[model samples]
Structures are given as structure tokens and as C-alpha cells.
Target chain A: MIIVAVLSIIFYLLSLYRGFLIYPGFLLQVAYMLIRGIQLERLPLVGPHDTLFFLSSSLVAFAIPFMFSINDERQFVGSVSVIASVFAIFSLLSRPHNIPLPPVLRTYWFELHVGLSFFSYALFGIAAVLGFLYIRNKDQETEILQYKAVLIGYCMFSLSMIFGGIWAYLAWGTYWLWTPKELWTTILWIFYSLYLHARLRKEWMGMPSVVLGIIGFAVTLFTYLGVSLLMKSSHTF
Target chain B: MLCPAYISVKINMFKKLLAFFFSLRTAIWLLLALLFMLLFGSLIMPARPEFSSLNSMPLFDWLGENKAGITWWLYGSILLLSLLTANTLLCSIESLIRKQQSKKWLLIISPQIIHIGFLFMLLAHLLSSTGSFRGNTVAYEGSALALPNNLAVAIKDITVELSPSGYVSDWAVNIEYLSDGKGIKEDYLKPNSPSFYKGLGIYLKDIRPYPVKTVLLEVSREPGAVWALIGGLLFMLGTVTLMILKIKKESSS
Candidate 1:
């Protein structure tokens, strides 16, 4: 698995120049996740290593569609490949421990919650990269793509939160908790909500909205990792 | 009729208030305020011991008892949320009234539906905060625990499957609900799978088989569960519809 991940990273880096090399990298990343899932007998999203890999894989997956659709495919594809490679490298650096899935994580709802959350994270990550590209090149098409990514990511994130709420209600008899992780998740959601509303105004369309998209992804990363690492929360894993 | 100037002034004030509530700018600022408040609360929660009581009881109850110095962010968040709710309601109302003549019904109504879903979710939290109940109790086989409303739960059996490495692989607790000392219903509770009886839910929190087979169960009554589910579904439906419509419009254009 490690060797496959290293090869995937190598291809992702090569794609920064060749652009088409991302396909092999993306396939290898998918294969890595598939193998991990089969070995774990569940969704391989329990720990940091698995989730980072999933995020990297999802970033490549989402970037593929945009690569074909957008005019500046090379620049966009190159940026995404670098970002996904960084995530993959981080996943490789993290120790992979195969522990038995706990009973609380045995439900389909939990799996959906984690899966959709990471997928949304990947979308938001791509949106941030696109936002950066737009700032650099000042392209209207890049801005539109960023908006579309944020819109789709927002819907998926909302669905993930709903599933999470249901799972919490079933397992803990409450739809919400006052823990730091939940609080940060809400913060991330509201930040994106602000970005969406700001996009409607004529004044916030160009630079301000793009900055919000970039900052919003930072919040997403904090909610996913910083909360678990810095605070006492149920998402410690 | 008394004074035209007074009436004009009053009407102007009302219009200002309406505009304040229905403006998108207000929504953006309110959401930003809420995000900051929540971020502050998240920071303070881990730093202060007083904030730890937040999960021990209902939010309203905790708010009344906890120190304001430590919980000011929560109070601020609640105020911001209240303002945001009003903003959502007024904005939806304004949109519907203004777009009444528009032919594109889905585009006109999708955002309003999302607002309604948000209102429902807030209501669910309100109901749960005031009416919900949660408590934990430990019991073993043949043990009967008394509950509210002349009800009781009797543990019938307990099973724990452990791996060779002494880790719990699976566990279940068989229980029966009793009314007037007569068994009314039988069910089993496992992790992530709670048994609902009437308005109460029983969850198997933990199990131990050291000296005697014992299980820790959490009994809770969430008055907002159904409302939350409804709200969640409505939110998802509205968002998906709006997203699809936007995508279609963009592609066609």
C-alpha cells in the first residue's frame, strides 16, 4: 500500500507538468482506497491516514470533470494535482493502523457521514484552488467554476451534516452536541453560508468572494483536523 | 387622521425595520457574527471548566446556571441566531411577495423552502432544549429499573462477544418494557441501534462481563427527533433542487 501511494504521488507530481499523468495517479489512489476498504471490511475513513487518502482521491476525482470542462485545463489540472499530491504525501507520512471498527462506527449512517464530509472537503479544496487561480489570472470562467464547486460542495456538506445528526440521535439520543468538533463544523457551515450570500451582491463578486472561498477551505481543514488535534472532542480519531 | 406627519414617520420606521430584516446584507453580517461567536465558544469551551457543563444538561438550563463570563459567547450566539432566524423569515416573505408574478416557480420557491427548513431545524433544537430528557443507569440480568410515567424496563439477558485479544467484538442487551408490572413490549438494544418505546429511547452504552454481566443504558426522550428529521429532509430537498436548477440554467446559457 505504501509503495502504491508513493507511486501515486510520483504520478501526481509528474502531472503538474504533463497534466495527463493525473489519470494514472487518480487510478492508483482509487486502487489504494479500494484495497484499504477491502482489508478493513468497512469504509476506510476511520483514521487520519485513510481519510487523507480519501480526500486526495476525491480531489482528483472532482478535478477530472473540471479538467475537461474548463478552458484553462492545464493550469487548473496542475494546481489540483499538486494539492492532491500534498494530501497524499501527508497520508503516507501518517501511520496506518488497522484496528477493529468499533460498534458505534458500524452503522451505514456513520459511513455516509464521514464519506460525504470528506467529499465535500475535497470539493471545497478545489474551489479554493480555483479561487487562487482566478485571483492570479482574473478569469471570469474560473470564478464561475469556483462558484459551481462551492454550490455543489455546500449541498453535499449539508447532507453530510444531516446524516451526522441522525447518527448522533440514534447513538446518543441527541441531534446535536456542544463539543468543539460540532461547534467548529457549525462554524465552517456558517462561514460558507456567508460566502454564498456574499456572492449574490455585486460588490463582493470579484476579489472578496474569492478570498472567502479560500478562507472557507482553511476553516474546512480546521474543522476536519485542527478540532480533533487541538481540542477534546469525540472526533479524536 | 390626527396628524399626517406622525403617520408618515411611523410608516418610515416600520419600513426601515422591514428592510433591515429582509436585506441579504443583514443575513451575511448576522451569519458572520454567528460564525465568530461559535469560533470563540469553541475556543473557550476547552479552556474553561464551567463550559463543560454545557453537555450535562439542556442549553437553556445551562445558560441560566453557568457563569456569564464563560458563557457570554453562547449567549451572543443565541442572540445572533435569533436575529438570523428573523432575517430568514422576513427575507423569505419578501421574496415570495416580490416574486409572486414571476413564471419560474422553482427558482422563486427553492430558497424560501430552504429558509422554512432552517426554521424547522431551529424549532427542533428549541423543543429539544426545553423538553428533552437523558439519564444513564446500570443494570444486569433480572434487574428492573423504574422509569417515568409508571413504566419500567427489565433486563432479560445480556450477551457480549469478545475477540481472543480481549476486545469487545459485539454486544446486545435484551430488555422488556413493563407497565403495571406486566410485560408490554420486548426489544434488544445495541450500539448505534436504540430501541424506542412510546416517546422514550433506550441505548446500550456499554457492557461489562467482569464479575457479573452488566450493561450501561442511556434512556432519553428527544421531543425534537421527528422535527429534526423533517427539517433535514426538507433542507436537502430544497438545496438539491436549487443546485440542479442552477446547473441546468448555467449549462443551457
Candidate 2:
């Protein structure tokens, strides 16, 4: 796993010089990692370690189609590759362990809930990177790309929350809880809803939207890790 | 009759108020206000740990008492969210009314549908606040506990599985929901498999297998659950439809 992640980072760096190697390099790395995960009998999303690994893979997956379809996506791909590599390293650092799946989590809803949530988080991460770049470079194309990422992220996050609510009802007898993790996630959703509302106005479209995008990503990151680290909650990392 | 000048001034003020509620600026500012309040609320909860315990307390009672800063911040967030909800509803209605003139039905209706879903979810939570029931109870094997509406719940058996190392591995509580002194349904209440009877959900929160063969169960009845589920579906459908349309438009460009 570390080798694949390290090779991905190397290829991303090499792509900066060659500009053509990123496509095949990222694809091969993700394929190998995915094949390994398949051999493990479950999706790579049981704990923090596997979740981050899956996150990195999903980020690359989001970038792949855009890399081929859009002519202006090379720089975006480079930026995302750097960010995805960071997630890979973080996954390795978090002490990767094969979490024994409890009988409770052995359900389709559990996988769906975790997978969709992590996938949307990766999309929002990409959007945040483009948002920062848009602010610095003031590029219209990057702004459009950022908007698309946020739009897709918004959709996936909504679905994840729905699945999560249903999962809670099935597991804990209530659809909503006042737990710190649940509250923070709800706040994160509200932040993105605010971002989407801001997108409606012509005046707020350029820099303000990008800034909000960055802010939204910050909230997402906090909901993902800060809740577990800093606060007490029922969620097990 | 009324004074013409005074009537005109009143009309102007009302128009400005309506415009303010429907304007994107109002929506943006209201959202920002709600976010600020929520951030403050979340921060203060950790500072005053008792805030979590007081979740089931009524808002009016909390306000009537002299409390910590977190209480005000949390209530203030609820107020701001209410204002935002009203703003969203008004804006969606106004936009739909305007779009009617252009005859762009799909484009006009998609967002309004999402806004309606948002309102439905809020309504669900609001209605739930009135009659929602949550409680923790301990029931031993072969013992029955009577609940609201004369529904009785009894623990039939407790099964505990131990690992090779003699540690507890997994546990389950077999429970039966009864009505009129007869068992209607029997189900296993495991960690993830909670049983729902009528409108109530019964979960096995904890098990005591060492000294006493008893289980701690948390049961809750949420009348608004169905509404929230429907609202979630509508919200997702609206957003997905709009996203697909936007993607198609962008790709064509």
C-alpha cells in the first residue's frame, strides 16, 4: 500500500515535468490498490486507515474522466495528485490495521453510508483546491471546474446523509442524534447549502464563492477528523 | 377614505420588506448568521459539558433560567435557522412566480422542489419535538414491561457468544412485542438490527452477561420520521435532477 502511494506521488511529480505520464500512472496505482482491497473481502472503508486510502483512490477516480475529457484539466490533475498523495501518506501514518468487521457493520447500508460519505469528502477536497487556485490565479475555467466539483459533492453528500439517517434508524432506534459527530456533520451540510445559495447571485460568483468553497472544505475536514479527535461521540474511528 | 400619500408610503415599505426576504443578499446573510451561531453553539457545548445532558429540556424552560453562554448561542442558532427557512420559502415562491411569466417550468420548478423538501424536513423535526418519546429501560429474561398505548415488550432470551480466549464476542437479545397479552412479533435486537413495532423502535443498547442476564434497551418513537425520510428523498431527487441538467449544459458548452 505504501509502495503504491509512494509511486503515485512520484508519478504525479514526474507528470509536472512530462505532463503526459499522470494519466497512466494514477490509473495503474489505483488499479493495483483496488485489486488488493478486493482480495481483502470488503471495501477499503472500515476505519480511519482504510477510509483515507479509499478517499485517495476516489479522488483519483474523480480526476480521471476530467483528465481525459477536458483540455484545461492538466493543472487541476497535478494539484489533485499532490493532495491525494497527502491523503495516502496520512492513511499510512494513521496506523493501517485490518479492522475486524463486527457483525453489526456487516450490512449493505454500512458500506453504502461510509463509501458515499468518504467519496463526497474527496470531491469537496478537490473543489477546495480548485477554489484556492481560482482565488490566486483568477481563472474562469478553474472557477467553473470548482463549481462542478461542488455541485457533485453536494449531491453525494446529500445521499450520504440520507443513507446515514436510515442506518441510524436501523442501528440505534432514532434517525437523528444530538451527538457531536452528527451535529458537526449537519453543520457541514448547512455550510455547503450556504455555498450553493451564494452561487445563485451574480455578485457573489467570482471570489466570494471561491472563498466560501474553501470555508466549506474546512468545515468538511473538521467534521471528518476533528469530531473524533477533539470531541466525545458514539462514532468509533 | 385613506390619505393617498400615507397609503403609498406604506405600500413602498411593504414592497421593500418582501424584496429583502426574497433577495439573494438576504439569503446569503441569513445563512452566514446561522453558520456563525452554529459554530458558536458547537464550541460552547464542549466548554459546558452539561449542555449535552440538557438536550431533552424544553427551550422555553432553558431560556427562563439563567444559564451559560452556550444555551443562548444554541437557541440563537435555532432562531436564525427559522429566519433562513422563511427566507428560503419566500425566495422560492417569488422565483417560481417570476419564472411562470417565461414559461420555463422545469427550470423554475426544480429549485422550488428542493426548497419545499427543506421545509418538509424542518416541519418533521418541529412536529417531532412535540410527541417524540425516548427512554432507557432494563428488562430481565422472561420479564415484560408495559409501554404507552398498552403495548408490552418482554425479553424472551439472551444469547452471548464468547471468543476462544473466553472474552465476550457478540451478544443478542430476543424480544417480543405483545398486545392484549399475546405476542405479535418476535425479533432479535442486536447492535445493528433494531426492531420496529408500529411506530416505536427497540434497540439493545447494552448487555449484562456476567452476574445478571439482563439487557439495557433504548426505545424511541418518532412520528416525524416518515416525513423526514420523504423529505430526504425529494431533496435528493431535486438536487440530482438539477445537477444533471447543469452538467449537460456545461458539457454542451
Candidate 3:
């Protein structure tokens, strides 16, 4: 865990320095132009504001898990969670200027449903790594990475469903669409539901649960990005 | 033994096929395939059902016919989901069912609840997509409308506007409600809030005070929606509770 964290930090820092060096041919230069009074809405990949948010977020996400391996840690995980949260907040704010949520969509229900949804996925993103780690190892009795992985993944699954139901009730007058995105999300929730159920029953172990965990995260990624990219969502900005 | 060698060969062949068709590897491939195809669809494919001859195509053309290439896409997606659901259910059925005898029936009941919630969600969305609702603002400080049903809403006044600092400072909506052609209840609504009437719920999504309040009241209704909400909440609570108890027990043991 510590090694992975350290490697991630090194890689993230490298990406940052690379960003600084390659300023002209990319979004940073445009952001620099924006800083000098250009419009923010007209930028491309890796916008200036987005770059900062990713750098800081990746650092926090990379660095926090190291402490868990260092000693019995207290709230280092919680702090990292806060960082992931702030990353989502910045991402929400960093929308392309062409499209923005309507004023009506900016209400408290929107924040609770959509905001919580993003943060939950960010957590699951971290958990996916832990799940993969568990799969690689031959052992499963320990309360190491598998527990943490399943815990966060299941947490995200639960919270997303809750918020989604509420959002659907308010926005479209219904909860589940079984659309590609919704279907994949439900599949993920089911996959993890099986994970938690097996864990509690002490029947499934090692390769099986780990594999499920990893795959659940894969579906989670699709639910997050693949569907949005492929289909026009009912909840589009 | 009688034909021991032949039996062994048959067993080996079955194992190979079983491993091939229904394993974690296939699930991963299925997932990646969904991502790959969806990416392809979004980037290159026409928005929806591109026609060879626009004038020739009928007004209500079949979704599959216009989109010649996407039927397989849709079919393939359903196939993928079926495989995944089968895979997980197969893996976890014994464990899940084994605990049905446990005193904490929550384990058994929770999944059932979640499944019900999922079904309701699917039904609700399908209903919303197919069914239609009409929404138009009744202008003026006091304008009332009589719909086909006895349901009527009188817009006493609506004012919404943002303050100088971009905060919604002055926003208010006054509405008169009626049921069965009789004036019943009236209330003032603001942003971030809503009110309900006879299964017809109205939300003050936003307001812009152009002297008279321009109220954006989002309205939606489906019979027994509250039941779906209740089911969802129960499922979440039950899953969370069951997970915690199981984890604590395992760690303690």
C-alpha cells in the first residue's frame, strides 16, 4: 500500500511538472491567456482551473493511503475523503462554459442527488484499487484491503441509489429508468450486494469476491463515464 | 470402473466450456465491450436513426429500421447485462439463501426490498417516458385555469429575481389551489421547496422576480410514487444495517 501510494505521488508530481513544461501547446497556455483576461469557456482539454484541481486532488488521494500503512491511523482516510470531495466540487464547478445546469437544477435536491452521487463514485474509485489488490493476493482471511475495498464500494452503491431515487422523484417523477447508465449502476449495486452478502456469510473468499469487487468498479466506471459519453442522458446539463 | 476414461474426458470438456463461457474474464470483456461500443456509437454514429432518404422515410419510422446498425448494439447490451446478472446470482445464491434461516431475516428481506425498489424505479421511469404531462405558466398576478378535470390552480402572483451579489434575494409565489372545483388550500412557495396536492406535486424549482414573480414550478405525478420512495429508503437502511452487523461480527470473531 505504501509503495503504491509513493509511486502514485511520484507519478502525479511528474504529471504536474510535465504540465508546467508543456505550457504552450495545451490547455495551460490557454488558461494562462485566460488569466490575462481570456474567456474561460473557450478552452480545451486540461483547462487551467481543472489542471490545478486534478493536481491537488491526485496528490491528496495518492498521499493519504500511505499513512494507513504507516501505523494505526486515525481519520487520514477521512481527510483523504474530504480531499476527494473537494475534487468533485471543483469538477462540478469546472463545467464547460457551453453547458451549465439550469437555475432550477441548481436547487438543494440537485446538490444532494448529484453532488452526493459524484463524491460517492470518487470513493468507489479508490476502493477499486483495493479490490484489485485483494484479487492479486492468494489469501483472503485477513482484514486488509478487501474489507476496505468492499466497504467503500458498497457505501457508494448505497448512497448513489438513495440519492438517485430522490432525484428521480423530484426531477422526472420516477426513480429508475433501466437506461444503459441506470442498468449498469444497478448491476454494480447488485455485484457489490453479492460481495457484502458473501462476506457476511463467510462462503465466498479470495479470488471470487476480489474479482467481483474489481468488476463492480468497472461497471461503476461505465455508469459514470461510458454512458454519459455514449448516450444523451435524461439528466444532461 | 466402467468406461472411466470416457467419463473423465467428458467431465474435462464440460469444465473447459463452463470456464470459457461464464467466468470473471468474460465479464470483464463484456464490460469493456460495452464501453468500446458505446464510445463508437457516440463518436461516429448519427444522432438517431439517420435516413438514407429523409423525405421517403415515414413520420413514425421504426427505431430499428432507421438505425440499421444499433439493434445489435441494443441486443448486445441486454445480453451483457443478462450474463452479468447470471454470473453474480450464481456466485452468491447459496450464501444468500443459506442465511434465510438466520433469525435476522433482514438479510433475506433486504434484497427482496431492493429488488422491489428496482422494479418500481424501472416502472416509474418507463411511465414517465411514455406518458405526458402538460405545464405552462398562468401569467398575471391573478390568473386561473380550469383543466379537463376539476383540478384548477389560480396564480395569485409570482415574483422571482436575483440580488446584486447573485443570490436569489426576493423570490415568492402565491398560489390558490382547488379540488373537485372547490377552492381548498393556498400557500406561498419559494426556491428549494415544494408543495403537493391530490398526488399532483409542485416544486418551486426556481423564481425570477420580474416585478410579477416568474415561478418555475416543476410538477410530476405517478400513482404510489411515495411507496417507491419508501421502498428505496428501506432497502438502503436494511443493506447498510446488515453490512455493518456482518462486518463487526467478522472482525470481532
Among the numbered candidates, top TM-score falls to: 1
Give every collision pair in model 3: B158-B213, B159-B213, B160-B208, B160-B209, B161-B209
Residues A156-220, candidate 2, lDDT per residue (tens digit)? Answer: 98889888887877876666766678778888888888888888789888898999888888898
Q: Report model 2's chain A TM-score.
A: 0.90
Query: What is every candidate's C-alpha DockQ against the true complex, given to 2 decimals?
Result: 0.85, 0.57, 0.15
Ranking by DockQ: 1, 2, 3
The weakest ten consecutive residues by lDDT in model 3 chain B span B51-60
- What order do you get sorting by TM-score, best first? 1, 2, 3
lDDT of each: 0.89, 0.78, 0.51
Off by over 4 Å in 2: A23-40, A69-73, B1-6, B54-68, B101-104, B162-172, B208-213
Residue by residue across A55-82, what tens digits does model 3's lDDT show? 3343244434543552322333433443
lDDT of 3 at B244: 68
Q: Give candidate 3 regions above 4 Å deviation.
A: A1-111, A135-137, A141-144, A171-205, A225-237, B1-46, B49-140, B165-170, B179-182, B203-219
Error of 1 at B179 (Å): 1.2
Which of the predicted structures, 1 or 3, would earn the higher lDDT when compared with the native?
A: 1
Question: Who wins the lDDT comparison?
Answer: 1
Would candidate 3 be rated incorrect, acceptable, medium or high by CAPRI criteria? incorrect
Number of the candidate with higher DockQ, 2 or 3: 2
Chain B TM-scores, listed for every candidate in order, come to 0.95, 0.87, 0.58
Q: Write the per-residue lDDT of candidate 3 for residues B92-143, one digit (tens) a residue.
A: 4543666767886765565555545544544443344344253434345666
> In candidate 1, which residue ranges exceed 4 Å CA deviation?
B1-4
